[model samples]
Target: MPRLSLIASCLLGLLLAAAPASAREVSVPPWGSGESRGEDLSIWLVTFSPGDDVPSWWGHGSLVVEDRRLQQSRLYNYGMFSFSDAMLARFAMGRLEFWVGHSSVGSTFRFYREEDRDVRIQELNLTPEQRVTVAKRLADNVLPENREYLYHHYNDNCVTRLRDMIDVATGGQLREFDRAPGRMTLREHTRRYTAVNAPMSVLLDFMMNDEIDHPITKWEEAFLPDELESQVAALQVKGADGQLQSLAAKSWNFYESPTRKRPPAEPPPWGPWIFALGLALGGAAVGLAAWERQRGSRVARMLLGLENAVLGLVLGLPGTALFIMWWVTDHTVTYRNENLFLANPLTLLALPFGVALMWGSQKARARLFKVWVALVGLGVLGIVLKLLPPFDQDNWRLIALILPVSVGMAGAFGLDRVLARLRGGDRASTGRSAAATSLKAP
Candidate 1:
């Protein structure tokens, strides 16, 4: 359950940025100031690598404006947000507000360095005029009224904001060149970063709908700081002399953390392993149920009841949350989720029936068997839906994990026997009921 809470808190963690409590406002020179001239100004993109905290897993980015004449540098970041109750409320509702803010470049580096996160910087190959333009925009972006923006995890965030700034300075050349297809979809990119925490990765995948499955261009992939860094480095933009040049004039790692390793290039292949685990659990449940049926032992019955109660919580709580995320919240990514079929909220009904079974109530066993059958049926329906084109969700991993469990549990609860009785009419049901009573007699 604590892991479940972590998943809830980190649902928007990929959109998070490095938020240092010591962040302070830094003054930026006016646009008309002599220091704003092209040659006197240089712009750099500062990228921080994934950190230990879930929020910092996707990394963070900020734009640094250096004024050689003034011997000063300011780091403008769009990731700033407070953890106040109001902000948390909005975050839960998917209306969180993030803002641009600036601090001394030295302090920004010091913060991430102490956190043991790697830092990289790339100097843009912008011409004199473009440098001034980008610097001026960075300055104006920090103005109180202009700073705030509604955060969208994929479409807009700290990294994408800096990416758009670069595109503007490049006169849209960055966007033009990055229109080529990306290496992976948005969901794959997310899985790449979140793979460090396996549970978080699976839960997030379950919560998100198929909207993230569409193919995206490299420009759209710039939503991640590392992707933006790589894309910008590979780009060619027009210089002051009207000649094409590399977009990244120079790039280097500013700091490398000794403690942290970089995120994996690809997501871990956990599907088969998860499926095996589900199969093993389901098999154990069937074995236990068979033994209970043969001996009518109190111990076996209690164990079966315990298994039902635990599974109910394991599946039901997240299923309930997913239901709300689809219908109640503004979190568009979680809408129309197909995982709802496998992890159905109706599984929660097993709790009371399980308790009744533990108390040796035959009626509870009959009702629980029907509930398990319904759950199995829903899981089968989900599989059937996947055969259609419109329901093109990449949920094979989830299906592999949940379907076997549902089917095995239903079988363990005597689904075949129940179905046979229903088809055999009242006469056969009377005989089956008498046989069931004789089997249960101690």
Candidate 2:
């Protein structure tokens, strides 16, 4: 999930900029600008639970630094970005830019609380020298000249920023965390959160390629806010007594929202399965019409031809988009997709011939018969390829949904053409036999 706070903060930034210059500058003390210094500063890791919005589905993370003497708290957020028309275009193309921002902790906490999102905080155990060093690093990072960073969704984000900064403060001891056994792939982790957002889950599954299916290290999974929080809470570091100590000295939930009603029934494999069934039924009807050659069979054939052409055109879109992302766009995860063979855009180019067949062109139907046979072959090949190495894509759901439809549609058209041709030959032979008998009798 990208930063949900980014959109809100960007709008707020624009509104504040229109005010007077003195007022435009947020009253929050600039990072490290307070009169008080030394160990009076304490470091905290703040986490906000997942929200209803798409961007907030995975939650958020922020680092808070409090000055005891000044009685003020500041939040260092790595989730801010400048939103604009140009930025939207770049964002769509996967070239993202984000900035570290400084803001008052009171306002930040209030915002999440009002949104009814659960919030938690972990008081980090850091030496006085370590605290000052981390604070200074954050201060420099939030400076106008040093803030902007190229954001990668899974590798570099708000949560990762906090994790990295803490590791720095801990003298790399954070990296010594024991790997959690039986780690999951990035896709699995994402699916766990987005299961309720069925549509988004399907779209993400389609757009992202096999790159996400590879198992991620526990450290890599810490990019997610909740994962980072849990990992930080469990982290152990060297203590002054020569024993391991928990990195978090204390932890507590800052806010808890009212319970939410359970969501409606989810449409998981159901949606894809229904789509396959519909296609299969339609193909079956076409096969029956071709075999019977009834008075209305021509119309039925035309309609089936037209429908498949349209369906083919539509199905090709995701594959085409993936192709662009892999070859043309900068989206790293979409590169090297194995789903291309199963959802080839080349099928869409057959639309012109499908239209011709719909208009009752015998020549077009003859050519399309061959195409349908090829489709059956391709479907079978796709199934066989799944059993091979390097093609080991975990796309069983997609394969289940699409392969049967392909085979059904192809068999319907191919077998119909063959049966019709055989019947025509039989009728011609019978007519010739009847004419020869009549001539001989005369």
- Which number leads on lDDT? 1
Q: What lDDT would candidate 2 get against the real structure?
A: 0.67
What would the per-residue lDDT of candidate 2 be over residues 87-126, giving only the tens digit for each residue? 6556656676887887777777788888788778999988
Error of 2 at 159 (Å): 1.5
Error of 1 at 296 (Å): 2.9
- Candidate 2 lDDT trough over 10 residues, lowest sum: 14-23
In candidate 1, stretches whose alpha carbon ends up further than 4 angstroms from where it belongs are: 1-7, 26-35, 359-361, 415-442
lDDT of 1 by residue, 1-442 (tens): 3433443565756546645643576555644255556888889998899887778888889999898887777888898888665665576667888889888888788889989888899999988888889988888888888999998889889888999999999888988998899999999988989998887788778888898999999999899888998888889888878898999999988788887887788878888898997898788778778777667677988888888788787777777778876776688987888888888678877778878878888887788788888988888888898888888888888888877877777888884355446657877878999999999999
